[model samples]
Target: MGLESAVSLYDQSTRGRAGERRAPGAGARPLRPHAAGDRSVGFAEVRDFHVEVARRADPALALVPLLVGGDPSKRGKVIAASADLRSRGLVPGMGMVEALDRAAEARWVPTDMRRAREQSGLLRAAVRREVGAVEIEGLAGFYLCAPADREEALAVARRLEARVAEQMGLPLRVGVAPARFAASLVAEDAGRSGARVVVAEDFEQYLLAQPIDRLPGAGPKTAARLAELGATDIPSLRRLGLDRLEVLLGNHGRSLWLLACGQDPKPLRVRRHPTTLSREESFAGDERDPGELGAVLVRLSERLEQALQRDGLRAGRIALRLTYADERTVTRSHSFDAPVSAVRELAVAARALLDRIDLGPDSVRRAGLVLRGLEISGAEDRQLDLF
Candidate 1:
């Protein structure tokens, strides 16, 4: 079968089973162990993650072309598409109307970000149990450093695939290489094989074999520009040399050349917890009374104070957001002289900011409170006077 057909076929097979046909591997050789302490960056991508999740949530979505994003009648882009559509170059961020034009019979659904976030957390937790630290690219892809021992790294990848499959019902494909970019490429090319590992020695040939689209950050525009330079694939593009590429594409050209040479010194960015906390509530009717809105702000501030105390954190800045009945939103903020964690301090600051915004003729529909610049509380001074 052709490469496109093979990829489309695998993309369509989202039931936790391997593709019936496998494409030729980029670098199919078995992985050999490197020197001890050599860090190997590995990337794991859940194949057809959005489609698979939607299917699991509602089995009725199976065996049909599916499009997940905004309402078709509204102005929005496509968030995810079926494998066959994607194989035909229907990617995320394309206009929904254009996407519908391509897949006329496809079913469209709104994005379920809340559910996607929950599933992503579960996926991360499963991988974290196998490997201590991981950097998630999005809801579906993850980057991690594996053991120096090639066999052990392969075992970790296998275990991760099995763990996610059993726990989250998602299939995982992994690729291990000396650097993050190459590893990502390897993982993409791994396809239905589950995992592909490339040692430093084979990095050059393996990278050379990849197509131009595999290069990170090189979108259709870059491809068109490269085509203008008579460079169609990785090898031809490399012939352009660093000087010519830099001259042609500027700093971005330099980055492309580095990846073309299998040199990606970038490090994994481990995921961190949220730095800001916010609470919001929508009013039932068009409530324009200042006293009523101020009361709501006070309640929200108290809730914020309780949350800060529970987390042992203090906020250095407070913000208020008001959503008008016409759907227009406005925000105002104030910074404190020092971090504050008490309900009195939060309410005082929130009320002061709320006073700054003019309600105008628009009736208020929602009020929100946000605490920013958070830091761990050092000690409690209940006796300190703010007045």
Candidate 2:
């Protein structure tokens, strides 16, 4: 089968399984599963996806220090860099001028998104050929949920790594773990397209040995704050416990604490949208009124509905996030019984998620909505209603 057809087929099948495919009606609820640690989840991350594509186009650029972005004259940040360039302190988001200063002979090239997408689709197809359901993350990450036993997961990862090397001429670093977070972390080990199968029992120590800053969702800002608090590693954060961490960083800390102990239950979501869409509104001042936030949700949902309409897509899963006045953010998500594209349905889901949180007197400074698990509209009648 063609790459597009294979990816589209896997994408359609996963939409049903990832977010319960059911007619929207009474007693219908989307089931988000929490698999045990032994249920192998795989992470296949394409190493140097953009740079590798560029290298393939020009063979000589293989061993050279390369940066993907805009030319020196045109203003653009470094989007991706080769191992040699990154070793020289060139990171994504760095200015082109700074990069040039660091490496005078660096070959700066603009990333070809078209080629990236094409190569990514082929990689997804390769993984889907072995595993039934596949989730596309960004341009290079393909996650397979519950790919059977641990041995099967490892075998699939090895096969995928070799397949990409032979077929696409792109290297894919593979990791198999009991959960999504750990698997993704294991794949981050510095090297080209290596494979690491994290044992479920030994995962906690493996997780602790890694720096605290490596925790997913804990960005540079969060890491800096954690460092300031003297919790500079996973073990330190685990020592703080969930209740204390909650006091320190609000409810977001709860998830981080779980990561410290290797208990992250975050599921590997199916890529429902061609591109993940997020809409955020930051107030000039802290705003705590639920009614006011509900109004904002309506506007955001209207915007989300327009994007879905423009793309001829529907979102089966939605995530709600709020940043409080103290800068501590909390997020929650729900998968719908069926894909939703209407403003009213989106707003309803948004508010329902908002209601699940306790703001107390802490005013919310920001609110956002992220829609995922997109599928082509008119492909299936999810609900009995029409927009």
Candidate 3:
């Protein structure tokens, strides 16, 4: 996109962002990658996403240790720790008090779900305009299908990095690889280190050397299990032989092996048919009952499911939003194993997201569900995430 066009797009998408608050952190250098693209899949992750949203909106918060989450006085957990706080060893999921004890001078900022969603929507739209195919990883990350050839793919990525940083005021780390799993890992390191583009021919040698524990499904326990079996790295796992790995780790082993060798065939699901569906309810009064909130979510899910099916669509992502009596907003989302159009599946996912919120004894003044990252039914496919 041209500079004038990028500015125009930024203006249209970011009208309400003048009041955005941001946390402290220096941006990284732009990554320039040269590699052939053969069915290349790319990922872009916003560094310090929630905290950046806060910092950009509020200049005073810049260079401040900001915490995006519940009431620190009431002992809410830190959903997002700013880069400044993180540098001080404060991490997300730590209690607000603990975070403050770690960095007693930090600021507690209530999360603005509505603003975050708007920013995410704007970023997705921007990517869709420059690049044809895109997949949203919640509010902070994006998966893009690079152009078939390498040159155009790299150009799109360069423009994307500049566009996001220039237009959105959000720094992005771009990773282009043959497979999604590898692309995600690349994005993580690239976000902090620099941009990385791995060609199809180099993927196996590039990805397999990384430790086996870095993959999503290979958490602490899974990594330990693999370690016990002497399958500590992708290359070693491949050398361990797929048959034995399958017996030892089930589908997870199979998936990891495929990811390592760039054999996973999950397609880049683009948002060809765009639709944003949301359901919400305002309570008569503050309701604190978990069951009541869950019931509302079920009703919303039932309606959302019907809407998706009626249109022959499925939601690739689902977010649960809540408004507290104090007027604070919370939005938590979960990616589906696969895009889902079923009520049971959607509700189950929604309830699970609701569980992630720490209501404690707080009353919910309003609640809602937003379905985005949409795709036409059967338009693309994805492998299930192994636990």
Candidate 4:
């Protein structure tokens, strides 16, 4: 998908709104901008761009890109409410009550991180299946084209994007470069463009003039600090020298310094298989009821089962992570004597673990399920051992 196309889709809400909103268990309704033509960029475009840039720079250099799926607003209600609230100076990460007070007409719905992550997983699967090799960065995105030549590499990226559109109903924006920071910046730019390739040379020049806030790791607070120091853009910040940057930004400062210089030491490693398959959700409000939480867990386990089945994999171990109201976290896990793919079995194990934790009502914020000890079905014909 070209950048212009992606933006057009984002702007094209179901009924003319900024996005389509679907409440849990509610029928899909037309709200605003309707789904249009495929809005994703071609992976080939990204791969070629990265190859071209790498040839111009050091051939051994790698490209690491990042993407935030369902960013700005994870849901339609959230987007609508955020906009209504933002007009009155209310922003994200703010107290819900304060936001409502600011915009009495606003309507806000909680975020569904689980849905977002599932969407992300679909995209990631496409990347892995189509691309030559990939290294998943985190829950949301991954890195690609490791020391690959221009032609073969670009082909892989193009295939990846195509597969993602075919498998998932989400559009992807891609960037490519010899450096991770540069790749991320360019991908975002391309995502916003009507074109696919944002030429690496042009991307570098573009990076120099852009504000620090545009950089991957620079948050609002860090941007403010940089602004106070007379370093507004990447180029200006680059002149601050590593020692001075380390003093001001500490570890983050040093990392920023490297990125500003168009270098990232993070290497890409190919995984023959995923280390784990997990689903996590962060509630908009704290909940105390185990039943309610268990219901969510059931939903998550179902999703995980679908994911694993889609990939033809099974889990040999299960793990649960729960974060309480006090910001304290706990984790528990159990190994299965035999691989399991059934959602009921997974949920049963998960519920047992949940029962052991003390998550008072109004204090539990997030919960996650991670499946490890993966074994490819039929790859090994060992007898099932139930311990």
Candidate 5:
């Protein structure tokens, strides 16, 4: 029998790109390549390897992919309204004007990466609380221990699914496969389905047919380049010699080659606590009144204030989460010159943030608030006499 383990990778930055695109001048600095037989892989290859190794240890390895929180709209109103708008065909990244034009009643908004990260961290903690020791692949996804036996793995997957939903109020999908790549692929297919499993025999076949672009780590540019080279599918890419692949895609090419053939060598690392606290909510129905949504922001601001007070802290930075009913979420944040403790003050700042947001009623279903850059509050700071 192969190794009895599991692998999972949470796709990073799923909250459709909101920040300015990195300038070409801001490209990552080149790093030293691993010496042959170094037995060490770059950070980029770690998740793929973790899944592969876990699968080798356990044929029933489960692969779970988590969309970052707030990738969906952050406004409670928008998230609640998104399901209806989706049927009309709008999606994240659509221009506000275009989305509105496509569906007059559609609601749309930006995402909040900070709050999403916070919510994701909570989900990770919740998972860890239940499962004594599980591997967190990254910020948004993790792998739970699944046994080699089919029934047992499925049972574990079910439990994981329930815990995530209960704690985070977000749906999670789990896919089990004999190989890590297969499991990841299947998990993507099972998005929003909660849980799914694929056997070894079908795993390889499924992988072979998948577009190279669909593979983890193979982004749009890389996929387009591969297609240009007549390597449109995983099997075709796998058929190319390693040297040829390296020449075509550089180190990333070599990494992709290894992944294509299901030969990954990385380990899963545990997640750590973030430096901040945050929360997000989605509405159950579309709300046309911005006032109603503003009321939600008031509640969110109060919650953040209470949480900071409980921790004996004050926030120096704050962010807003806006979710369109179309499932698109956007986040914006700012740092103040001084720390703030009052919910009313935070709400004022949040309103300023909201003014910058253009998403309307039909598409908004969720909203989120994130507070960070905290500093310990002293008794003097809290006393009314200080003013």
Candidate 6:
């Protein structure tokens, strides 16, 4: 978009929000004016990360069909597969046994997450060298904010891709667009060692031409439901106004409607650390028993603890969200004097916060725990209390 249109959109998006309350470390920052006039956003993906890792590890596997995952004999699922296997419908998340059946001669490479993490860090550093900051998309991609117009954005992406390839020996495919989500989808569709650039004028037309399934959150079930509603593409989806979509699909439907209307971009984030970690579960029915709710909290805390340990991080705040059967939600939060990573500590804090909430006649249908104010495990000193 041009400078005027970009500023207009930013104003529209942020107009009426004054003194809005936001949870700490929630990644709630909105888009702001760029430092150097208008800029475009882009996504860069490390094409076939696992397959490339396997090839780099052993040159002999360069041309072979490789399936990366766990033991098929133990009900493992496919993590990544070679291009040939993917073309044959052997995609990630398929059962290893099924994947093996599809490509009988495909070599099985055990998932090397440690190596992947190391490589991903290297890739991010390389991209940041060219672009000041980036938002990491899982372990294989990055959301980059470029310095100037569409052409400059495209050139930046190209330079980053080439530099990453030279330094890390990994190929990157980039997509530049006026919107973040559009950039992500375009990057996913871009050819190996190439970039796709979508200008502001072409943004609307490009989005309308994309299949409905291309939008995130429009999974198989939602896509089928949309098809049943006679909406098979972005244009048809947009025709269903915001109110109708909200009534039919709830919040996700509203979000989809917004994206369909092209309200998806925001200022890019650096995201050096994950903003928040949360786990939630819905009850089979309305639940009033405190014991059941407490058990769920413990389970969620344990899951968060595992994630914290995996990431070598700790949380300084925890928020508990209780969703009533009527779809209303109440959230209560507490901050820790010292960051916590233990399940026991998290569960205790959550239970304390839960007790503070006045649960009336309403029964909770879902419970969730959000961990924020995160930092590296050893970043701060702990205070010891004398008994």
TM-score of each: 0.66, 0.61, 0.63, 0.56, 0.47, 0.62
Residue-level lDDT tens digits of model 2 in 1-387: 443554354345434546654231113232222335447677888877889889998999988899998766777889899888888789989888889889998898887875665566566656665564667777788777645465776777788778878877888888877767778877877268778887666565577688887888889988987776568887677654555455556668777876776666476676433556677888888898999999999988987887677556789999999999888999999999988899999999999999999979999999999999888787776554554
The pairs that clash in candidate 6 are: none
Which of the two candidates, 2 or 3, achieves a greater lDDT against the reference? Answer: 2
- Which candidate gets the maximum lDDT versus the true structure? 6
Candidate number that wins on TM-score, 1 or 2: 1
What is the per-residue lDDT of model 3 for residues 1-387, given as tens digits with 9 covering 90 to 100?
443554354344333458452221112122112234456888888877888888888988888778898888888888898776787888888888888777878788987875675576566656665675567777777787775556776777788888777778777888877777778887776754246777766766776568877776778987887676676777666665555455455577666666655655355676644578887887999999989999999998887776676556788899999999999999999988888899999889989998999898889999999998888777764423332
lDDT of each structure?
Answer: 0.76, 0.76, 0.74, 0.59, 0.57, 0.78
Per-residue lDDT of model 1, residues 211-248, tens digit only:
89878878998898788777899878876666556545
lDDT of 4 by residue, 269-314 (tens): 6564587888888788887888988998998899889888766688
Model 2 TM-score, all chains together: 0.61
lDDT of 1 at 264: 67
- Kindly list the per-residue Cα lDDT of model 5 for residues 1-387, writing each as its tens digit: 111110011112112267443322132333221112211111100122222222333454333221111223332222212433545654444444555556664323333444544554556566656554555555556654445455666676777778866765555667666545455566666655456665544455666777777667889987877776678887678655455555445678777876776555344443332357776767788655768778888988887776666555688899998877776778888888888889998888888888787765456778888888776676445686768
Question: What digit string (tens of lDDT, one per residue) describes model 6 on residues 1-387?
Answer: 343554344344433467453232123333221122366678988888888887888899988999999899999999998888898999999999988887889999888875675566567657766775579878788887754467677778779888988998888899987777888888877876688887777777787888888787889999988787677988788765554455567678767876776667245676655678877878998999988999999998988897777666899999999999999999999999989999999999999989998888899999999999998777744423322
RMSD of each: 13.0, 18.7, 19.3, 19.6, 16.6, 14.1
Extract clashing residue pairs from model 2: 272-373, 272-374, 273-374
Ordered list by TM-score, greatest first: 1, 3, 6, 2, 4, 5
| Candidate that scores best on TM-score | 1
- lDDT value, candidate 4, whole model: 0.59
The alpha-carbon deviation from the true structure for residue 383 of candidate 6, after best TM-score superposition, in angstroms, is 28
Q: lDDT-based ranking, best first?
A: 6, 1, 2, 3, 4, 5
lDDT of 1: 0.76
Question: Model 6, poorest ten-residue lDDT window?
Answer: 28-37
Candidate 5 C-alpha error for residue 157, in Å:
1.1
Q: Which stretches of candidate 3 lie over 4 Å from their true place?
A: 1-37, 87-89, 148-150, 192-194, 265-267, 279-387
Report the C-alpha displacement of residue 188, candidate 4, in angstroms.
Answer: 1.4
